[model samples]
Target: MKTNFNKEWKKDRIGSAHSGENPMVIAKMRSGFAAIGDTQFLPGYCVLLPSKAFGSLEELDFKQRSEYLLDMSLIGEAILKVCNPRRVNYSIYGNTDAYLHAHVFPRYNWEPEERIPYPVWQYSGEKWRNFEYQYSDKDHGKMKEKLSNKIYELMEKAY
Candidate 1:
């Protein structure tokens, strides 16, 4: 069996430009930052992708590592200002994708699901299962058609 099964990063990409699904994305940092994942319990659970191509912070130079941490801090602050989560959690484990990224999550005071530490994915049993598989263009436009413009404005301010 092949140990180094090189996964195609492009296939599973999640950022706004890549996925073309999530509307919550406000900004994407340069390569030396983090990846794009479900920012956790918050509405804008985001991933701060590493600016460099690799995932090992230890492998990075002093400058690279410092910048990455700075970027993470900035992203976390932005998320808190935008999402207003009760608390924030940062986790960096590249076991699955082996990409350099930070999991930026906002823990709120009130969560709808049962008392557990699992993500919404584990709760829903699938990704984005609360919505339908696909929708017509009309429904797509209608999806955000009702939302106030203030949210987008806030994103601009936060990002």
Candidate 2:
């Protein structure tokens, strides 16, 4: 039977990270986990999920909030380095999932002229939700490796 992957991932992200079940995870940060997005339509899309389950960023203490934002920026920079997008967009919206997480999307200049300047959400529902955009091990492995290496390199330079 096919599994509800997102549900399963959300059930035990920490444990999955420790056990290596969640392949999207790139690195662990002080306040959260950095992971590549399951969808690669935008190339280096990624997310920063809080280590401890929290409803929203408002629930985090000042230090934790700052750390999460910093980690988000780290992921964005890594994507920028590896994907060479024209710009990176950062968004934190907990409307669907209550979990405190942030999305880092890399925007490319090659995108259609009409869609390039707008949010990714403005794309047609089919384009946004197409299963063809789903991650594949063979296709995405190199991207994951490049992003992971860039993230570690950035972390080293920050220290």
Q: Which prediction has the highest lDDT against the true structure?
A: 2
By how many angstroms RMSD does model 2 differ from the true structure? 2.6
Residue 53 displacement in candidate 2 (angstroms)? 1.4
After best superposition, candidate 2 residue 55: deviation in angstroms?
1.2
- Local accuracy of candidate 2 as per-residue lDDT tens digits, 78-110: 998899999999998878776778999999988
Question: Could you say which candidate leads in TM-score?
Answer: 2
* Residue-wise C-alpha lDDT for candidate 1, range 49-144, written one tens digit per residue: 654447577877887777667667666665566567776677777887787667776667787647346654454534343233222233332222
Question: Which runs in model 2 stand beyond 4 Å of their true positions?
Answer: 1-7, 10-15
lDDT score for candidate 1 against the true structure? 0.50
RMSD of each: 8.3, 2.6
Which pairs clash (backbone N, Cα, C closer than 3 Å) in model 2?
none
Cα lDDT listed for each candidate: 0.50, 0.81
